[model samples]
Target: MSNQHFLTLQDIAPQDLDALIDRAITLKAAHRAGEASPQFPGSVMAMIFAKSSTRTRVSFEAGMAQMGGHAMFLSPGDTQLGRGEPIEDSARVISSMVDIVMIRTFGHDIVERFAANSSVPVINALTDDFHPCQLLADMQTYREHRGSIRGKTVCWLGDGNNMCHSYINAARQFDFKLHIACPEGFEPRADLLENNSDRVRVFHEAQSAVEGCSLLVTDVWASMGQEEEQARRAAAMAPFQLNATLLAAAEPDALYMHCLPAHRGEEISAELMDSPATIIWDEAENRLHAQKALIEYLLKTA
Candidate 1:
């Protein structure tokens, strides 16, 4: 619990990341067996959303309820921060009454500033720069199906947005090789790629990146704030779409994953999404188990 905020996966040690995945597995099994321990009775978690979400919101709220805790959802319209209150002021005020806080926002710096001023732990549900929580569920799902990700090759196909950036961090933390394939102008942050060059590589061709990969992942071409660029991105990213033919380029046993709210025929073909290799449904479900372990870890209650 020394770390007050989970703004990015880079903030966590490699060993801790491994432990969290293991804890998530244990918690998941316990939950299914009706043996879960309610470790946060009377606790409260504040969920602040500057960006709307389905998975992030449902997972956190449901996880809190399952743990015997309460979750309060606050949007820009519901909070004074929408009216120009400083994020620091809102953080201090909200954290004072809550046991934990999870923020899904635009800028990465907003959560950093909030965590710096808060008394309780802060979780980065998502940001334009990183989506560590989703990575947790992804890694858990991978391990449950294929064991340790260490020494494995993962292919990321599509936009170099939050999910891609988080996968870069996951490669470093999980000790795996990551090959990222995206359109030229849509590459991930240069600093992030440079920092983890030892484990990450970028490619313009999705086929080249997926060759021999054990996991193939993708996200929408245009993210929440990039709706205006839809047509332009579609043109640039059309060649990189994940389909049966493109997936065949990967290893025969490679698993397919996507952070949900996927565009059926944009990032992936409709048939590919329902293909046997796709484990996206499990990946989505793991969000609840993974976040529960995170909450337990942050609260020192595990």
Candidate 2:
């Protein structure tokens, strides 16, 4: 344990990152066994959200309460930053009042600013560029089902959004092989792609991406703030949809995943999501346990 902040998956080293995933799995088992965790008894956490979220909000709040801690949800409208106050001042002020800060926002720079100015640990719940928390849950789910993620092929379909970026970050730490399928212009940013080592490969065809994949993942065609381009995105991503035919291209035992709030027919087919191979629900539930492990680790270690 150390004074650390989790702003992205890449921030966590290989062994430490694996430990967090293992801790998350253990916490989830404890919860299912009706055991209680008072790891943060009497502590308080702050969640600053500039973007609206369903999973991120619920999971972190419930996780804090479950660990005998309280969580406060602060929207942009509730903070002085909305009134033009500097983020540095807000971060310094909030850090003194809470044990840790969790932020979900539009800009990666905003989270970086909060981390830079804050005394306590800061986590990136989500950003336009990365969703590290979501990838934690996804990685935990992968390990639980497959025993290990090292060397496993996880194919990503649809737009190269935040989840894809975080997955690539995680891939760098672990041995998981990543193949991302996107339309010509919809591929992940070239700068991020260049940072990857030998574990990742990009593909223009969905079939090629899923060829030998152990897991198949997809996200909504349009993420928040991208709704204006939904029609164009949908048309360009039509061929990347996760359906029965596409799933057949992967390994026989390949599992399926979606960082939910899925757009039924857009990024995935209903039949595929309803199938037994889909671990979407389990992955969603793991978000709570994963965040609990993360919060407890940050508060105790930091």
Candidate 3:
């Protein structure tokens, strides 16, 4: 939590990272039990989003507000950075005014620069390469329903995007067996594959990926700005859909997960998302709790 940056999962030590996760779980339970307080009184968080979002925006804003902190939204076109101000300058300026800075942007380097120059804690809301916050909520969800993440099997059935990258990173720190099922061209990055190959088990087949798995996860087949290829992506990812047949291949109690704003019949079936085993609402609710813990962890260090 020290040294002033949250550039990537690699920035956090494994043990400390686990401690944060444990804290998140505890915080989530406390909040649900109506025992948690708005600990961030009079604090402020600034959100710089070069990319658009619905859940990320609402979750962070509402989470901070619930913790007695206010969030200021700054979109790319609405800010001076869009007019050619150096990112470092914007980072330094924002750090001076806020208790914490959250950024959802295009490249990883943009977030890295912000964290590097900022004095306050830098939180990655999302980026082209990693989605640490989302993963935090995800880990909390697993802990809630599944008891423990260690020694469990997590099956990812979609493109190896930022979410998949963070999941693989988490797998390395925790003891979960990860099974990634992506189409040939849609596989996770090679370097990520190599780094976590020893820690996780990868699969090209959805059946093999979900077999005996404790959890099944997926994301949008086509992410934002990739709308041009929606048809192509849908075609490529159709066979991997989370329908009843595929869900049956996993553990009988296997839970379903998706980073929200799911395409109803595209990536997951409506029935599965509304099923008894679905914990997505819990997952969605935990986004607030997980971020509250993350903010507390970083602010405590300060």
lDDT of 1 at 60: 96
Q: Return the top candidate by lDDT.
A: 1
RMSD for all candidates, in order, please: 1.5, 1.5, 1.7
Return the TM-score for each candidate structure: 0.97, 0.97, 0.95
Off by over 4 Å in 1: 1-3
Please list the C-alpha lDDT of all candidates, in the order they appear: 0.91, 0.89, 0.85
Residue 109, candidate 2: C-alpha displacement in angstroms:
0.5
Q: Which 10-residue window of candidate 3 scores lowest in summed lDDT?
A: 1-10
RMSD of 3: 1.7
**lDDT over C-alpha atoms for residue 230 of model 2:** 95
- List residue ranges in candidate 3 displaced over 4 A: none
Clashes of 1: 0
- Tens digits of per-residue lDDT for model 1 on 171-200? 989999999999898899999999999999
Q: Candidate 2's residue-wise lDDT over 103-130, tens digit each?
A: 9999899989889999899999999999
